[model samples]
Target: MRTHDWFSRKKDCDDKGDPEAVFNVLDSMLKDSLERLKNMRESIPLENVGFDSCTLEAVNSRHATLFGCLCSEGKWKTALWLRRKLIQKGAVLDVFAHNLLLNGLCKIRDMERPDCLIREMLEMGPPPNLVTYNTFIKAHCLKNNVDKALYLFSTMATDGIRPNRVTCNTLVHALCKKGLVDDAKKLLCETLSDDKEKTNSDLITSTILMDCYFRSGDTVQALGFWDQMLHKNIQIDLVAYNVLIHGLCLGQHINVAYGNFAEILKRGFIPDCFTFNTLISALCKEGKVEEACHIHDVMLKMGVAPDKISYKMIIQGLCFRGDLVKAIEFLNCLLEKSLMPEPLIWNLIIDGYGRCGDLGNALSVNNHMLSLGVAPNVFTFNALILAQIKGGNNVRAYSLKKEMLLNGLFPDLVTYNMLISAACISGHIAFALDLYDEMLRKGIEPDIITYTELIRGYCMRGNVKEAEKLSTKMRRSGSQIDHVPCKILIKKYCHLGEHDMAFHLYQNWLMREK
Candidate 1:
């Protein structure tokens, strides 16, 4: 049978009071609707494809289930259509269904609709429950709107719904994220005092608090929390151990962190990506790239797949230590593993080669990136332009700027500064001035560097008056005249045998300093 005919026959069977037939129809329709929703390139009017009143009434009892399924799949518009249809049919969803919808909305960061829905639930029947409140609290907390989350937490008490462990943990995490560790600790202590039994079972909350204290540089308190967890016979997990390891690394105690890593292995707990990443990052920062590389090899040998962050940290370490050859090897290894490193990673290699005056490799890497379909960003272009300028190829650097515009990327402050400085150095003062004018037209405000370059350009061409006027404008624009430009003007005056004018300029500088 054709697909539409099959659906129609199932609907006819449903109408004949065959309950099993009705469920089969629902299952088929749900699958079709979800597929259509997934395939839509852009949202269209829901009325065109959504169930009408007649069709909604056909699957009367399963409406909430259907709505929940739609919400779970993140088809918000379709879910909204179903919700409106159910309300128009005077079908009231239970608190559970309402909570599911609210959760879905929160996940999409649709704060406005969720607020309205919660208000409707509060004013009408099927009032919000613990899950409903927790969903909102967690959503708000995730957005860093901790003030709003705290308001919701207090409102829950007024609604006679006691906050549970999930609620407490969410709030504690948010507070700690905002650097309010003391506030988080206070809240955790109050909650523990209220429910003594919770203190023993709440490993997550304790771990968060310990991590918070460690981040805030309170190693004593962090260790105290760890000792308390052990004394209370709380089961330590891999996450807690990772936190302790991370804290020790943060405290510059790499030896202690490694000791804990060995302990973790002895205890039969596998160190995951995070555990390895933390140690690698710390060792890289400490200029121990060899040690970090060994750990990377060890993790791979142990069949623990390194993530992008793992590769990124190790690559960055190699690049920072000027080991471009090793960095490129890692980049190729990342590609061999079918993991596409982001353009920033590619940029790092380009920049490393550029820093070593290897413009050939820099351009080659850039071409390779394009061949792999990764468009170079402004930073990539800036690094290339700098390399060209350093190679005394000013024309090529200017041509790159034109290429940037063709690629729909406008010249930023750094781009303008580099080109302008290059132009001034090559005695193209007229072109440098034109670029300065272009910068102003493009609304790119000139900083002290821009003015300094322009002033030096003028002084080099023996246009002392123009340089002095530009210096006055620079001060008026709130940029302090640094020693470079000031000395340039004074030397220019002295060179032209204008001793009085040079003395006057020096006296003015002293007055400003005073």
Candidate 2:
């Protein structure tokens, strides 16, 4: 290549990603150009016109082209310097200079100067056009003032300017976000009723309509609207399918959701973490564990790296099915790679171990959780207590409760209710009553579960007298902790031939629902 061509190519790359070469070229070229333009002015136009006129005229077409290239590369300062030289000529700036200035102002938030700059643009010979209005609307949209963007649309028509497809699409998007779907429909009807192929056929506008339909639970219309968009040949992006897939999942149609995900792949779009997470969750909800695992293998096969959420979804599914063994193995896999699971993921594993009467595994997982610097909260300790009680180990369960209090985490109603129920189920009526008193002394108000557990404990002990007393107390307390306790009372009383008390209890329980 010629030496000048080599220098030019290197100089251009400098502005792109090679700043060093860009700087070197501009430094040498700027000094040489300025000096040459000055000498040339001394030769010709300096005698007949203002010195600044010679300077602006010295800015040749080649110089403007170079300025434009720099602007495209985001070297705004260089472009601004060239504009200033032209303005200094006592020559009003031209349309190209004004448009570039508007674009630069919009790219950066020069909020205070927009109106002033627009006025100056008008003061120059060329008046503003549709491009100017669209740029201004885009500026408002960037600041998230959707209302002002709509106001610009009305102003455009009144100012005798014809709005284009982009202008209408921008208005539709802004209105839909504000939930003014009716007004959006009204505007679209007026504009696109006669020209459905031109206006209703716009992809951006149709995408927002699909979003509204999906959100409103009109899934039928939401899916059908795709045909219009497809007819217009407006390529649906990832965001479009994301919204659709989410809607399908909400309606529990996981199969359809998977179909949409496949379409996204067929269209050459890469599925993001959100897409994968949604798909995994749907598969898990359907208990398709084997298919969910297959997705993990496919993700690796296709080079789609699984994010942390992907691991969390699969782990949560295994935990839900009481397969804590596999869940723990997967969790360890993530940890070996140094990715700590979230607290919710840990809680799922804890719940699984607790339910299986495995206090040892539960406590082990809780200890590993603390080692990861995630503190166990009220729900965390509650799970362990429930597990131990289920395992017939109340002594250790109470110890865990003490540890919980010392950790500054107070037991909530769920902890109290579960503890008392464990006592009842274990036939420890006296222990259940003692805990109920302690709960009252602590000023923790008893709810339906607390009262029902107490009543059930008395009935279990065959102490019909005390059970009747507690039933009266529950009646005055007003409302069912559970109506099932009333049924238990009915069954017990009728078995003993005390039909009168059973009738009274059933009548009171039924009245509360009214």
Top candidate by lDDT? 1
lDDT of 1 by residue, 1-514 (tens): 3644555676435433655765798899999999987657234433445668776445544765776788889997888778877666456566877787888899998699989889989997578899999999999998899999999998997999988888889999999988898898888777655655565447888899899999989999999989988898887899999999999999999999999999999989989999999999999999999999999999999789999999999999999999999999999999999999999999998988877878899999999999999988899999899888888899999999999999999889999999999999899999999999999999999998999899889988999999999999898989766777788899999999999999999999889889
The deviation in Å at residue 245 for candidate 1 is 2.8
Q: Candidate 2 — which pairs collide? A: 14-18, 448-481
Local distance difference test scores for all models: 0.88, 0.77
lDDT for residue 286 in candidate 2, whole number 0-100 = 88
TM-score of each: 0.79, 0.66
How many residue-pair clashes does candidate 1 contain? 0
Candidate 1: which stretches are off by over 4 Å?
Answer: 1-64, 80-93, 194-201, 458-469, 486-514
Please, what are the lDDT tens digits per residue for candidate 2 over residues 437-505?
988888888887887888888887888889878877877887556667778889889988999888987
Model 2 alpha-carbon drift over 4 Å, by segment = 1-180, 187-201, 426-434, 437-445, 475-482, 494-500, 503-514
Residue 113, candidate 2: alpha-carbon lDDT: 59
